[model samples]
Target chain A: MPLPGPLQDLVAEFQRLPGIGHKSAQRLGLHLMAQPVEAIERLASVLVSARRALSRCSVCHDLADGAICRICADPARDGGLLAVVSGTREVLALERTREFKGRYHVLGGLLSPLDGIGPEQLNIRTLLERLRDPALREVLLALEPTVEGEATTLYLSRLLVPMGLTCTRLASGLSAGAELDIVDEVTLARAFEGRRPIA
Target chain B: MLGGNAQGKTNLLEAVATLATAQPPFARKDAEVVRFGAKDAIIRSSLRRGGYPLRADLCFRTQGRRAAQIDGVPCRRMVDWLGKVTVVLFSRADLDLIQGSPQGRRQMLDRIIRQMAPLFHDEEARWSRLLVQRNALIRHILTGAATASQLEAWDEPFAVAAAAVSRRRAALVRSLAPRAERWLEVLSGGCEALGIGYKPGIPGGDESMSIEGPEFVASVLEALGKSRAQDLARGHATVGPHRDDWLARLDGRDAAGFASTGQRRSIVLALKLAERDLLREAVGEPPLLLLDDVLAELDPSRQEALLEAIGDGVQTFVTSTHLSDLHGAWRARADICQVAPGHIARPSVT
Candidate 1:
């Protein structure tokens, strides 16, 4: 027998996720159906509220609940040291380390020419606007270590140089606890080239 | 089971192997596999795995463009779709793994590693691209078209990617060495001991050091820096895992330089068996085995040993010029297929 209309719709929605296949989507839909009526209702309400409450920050373009994000509003954070990233997820990842007490400018997405994502498509203009402040001395590229990320970094670095701001990239090398024999060559080379002398 | 020489026997086996890995074992570029005067070629197969029927399609065009599809859905990334089907192929050229250039041995290691860890393909592809680009930058620097600082920008990523390739290659050799040794002993009737050692291309790397560890990347980076002047003179990047090799030893002697022809063949056979065993352990089921005119290369006793190694419950495809070249038992127990120009006779069930 065919699935009911609403259940079929739920399966179709689940299938739209990145890794979910048709079988898995069907299983997820059935699993959702088995949940208590109040639990389902609560999930739907939370989903709507989360989507409705979040908006892109006006200055940095990071996910914000208001016109400006908390980091941009915070005076304690270093406004001069701006870490440019691809998304809010990267901002959160950098935050977990607590290494940088600087503000972030999320590009919303990386520049992928093949995918039609160009400089104009991203939040690059807003980034340039934020950088116009003479107080912003350095721009740190906190992008993923990928070809696309590298291209975006290069493009942004060239743009930043004309503005007289120092451009830097996240140091890519061997991870902590990674062994010498198991480390990939690219990371190894990066670590070697990026090595600092011990005082 | 029976076909004349150069009658698509090897090509058929190559096609099956390509289906599983999305790469042609013998061709460095996909264009090399396409027929002369033909613009493109397609290899498609319907496979049944774990009670599920799946279809794989690979399209190869000139100038190195290719596409892959699984179950009628195009795969955006080759890494995401690889390893859905596992295979082990034994060809006459496998003899080169022991007697030929280090490049061939490296390719052998890569094939096995790709099956063991599908993600290794992505790492290898990234490393390959970085190496090519870095070498091109070196050439540009040599010609005064680019600056030294431009080379500096590429060094870090090159080292990182190289370290990954070296590490994976080292780990694969470590895992495969003992298994190959065991198989060699069985194949040689416990008369010979085989040793397999990973010889990294980095200057300080040895059998004792872990090739995939953090220090390996550091050392490789240092080596690349040291070789920059030399590389600039030569107009290419010279040092890294692309030049790395694995040493096959027979009773502690370098097999490539000292082992007899029969010994080399034995080593190749043992490595294939070890590969099959490792794949079985990795996927929890035996992989399909493709033997392309390789059984005829082995003597009767070695052939019997090969048959014994295959055991039971494994799907195997063996191509040869004659049924007489195969074991008598294989002739009786296995279904027979005949191949001719542009034709393949269906397997006749006994």
Candidate 2:
């Protein structure tokens, strides 16, 4: 027998996710159906409330409940240093490390010409606006090591250089705990390039 | 059971090569390898190396896709499974390395380098993707859909990836040149001195020096910047590792221009032998050698030199229409198998 319309719709939505095939989507849809009605109700409520609560922060374009994100709202964070990233996920990733005490500017996404994404499509205007602070000293690009990430970094650095702002990118090299023998030659070469001298 | 032309001798050898590399050595596309009236073709082999058993299965669909498995586990990516069963295929087409365009020689270098450094496959994939994306962006810039500033985004990464490829190619040539010289001297009875020179696409590259890491990346970026005007006009990347080539010089002269057919054959043989030696040293096991009806093309002396180079460690599979085509030593040491239409049989030694 054919699944009910809502169950079929749920299966289709599950299939839209990466790595979820028809069988897995169908199984997930069936599993959700077998659950108590209150469980589904709870899931729907949580999804709606999360959507309602979270909006992009006006300053950094990061997820926030208010107009400004917590990092931008915090008085202790250094406005002199701004870390630019591709998306909200990278903001969370950098936050997890607890490494930086500076503010952040999310570009929303990298500049991908083939995808019809350009400088105008990104949050670059706001980033430039944030950089208007005379106290802002350095702009750190925390982008991926992929081609798109590097390209975006290059583009931004070129733009920032004329503005007399210091621009830098996250160091790319072998990951911590990665064996030297297994690391790719490019990463190994980069590690050597970025090697720091000890006293 | 030996037959004439259009038989399955070369086909069987190609199947073995396919199993080893998950790619047919001769076919340009996967669909070309599939037989007429067949939707797909499967090549499976049970191999043993260093007392360890391995199985490789490759299926080529007519729809131009392939599926590969190693040891009964599906490979998520072809690059992950490639080089697991290393192979060195010697065919008549290898003559193209000398007589054909620079692409063939570059492919030879890339194949050997990929086997020695499996990570090279990943680097190569990234390089190709970057090249495509950069080219597309260039087109967009030409069409006024994008601005000149946008090119900067791709330039750095393209330079980095290009440097990675060119550095490895340069290193491979540096290592293989001497080995090739030694092999050629042996094969030519000390009559020829072969030199393999790496000519990176970067303008003003120092042929004698080895540059890696940041220095190489800087040179590539500079080259890209210099070529930006021309590339913008052409709507594609005209500079980088994709345009790199390795020159084969005999007695310090360009082998492509002056070497005879016989010398070219010997040079190719020497290069393959050098590849085998390097793979042995790198992987700790000699790679399988697939000689596809090449014995008939070589003279007896060259054939003898090839056999001497094979030595005892490497496992070799040679295919020929006639058993008499091979040297007596080959017949004596080889397990003779007769390949006929649609069938193969192992005949007892006479």
Give the number of the best model, judged by lDDT.
2
Best by TM-score: 2
Residue-by-residue lDDT tens digits, candidate 1, B75-130: 87776567788899998889778879888889888887877777687788778777
Segments in model 2 whose C-alpha atoms lie over 4 Å from true places = A1-10, A31-54, A98-100, A161-168, A172-199, B1-8, B15-24, B27-45, B51-84, B203-216, B340-343, B348-350
Query: Which ten residues in a row are the worst by lDDT in model 2 chain A?
Result: A181-190
Candidate lDDT scores, in order, read 0.84, 0.84
DockQ of each: 0.04, 0.43
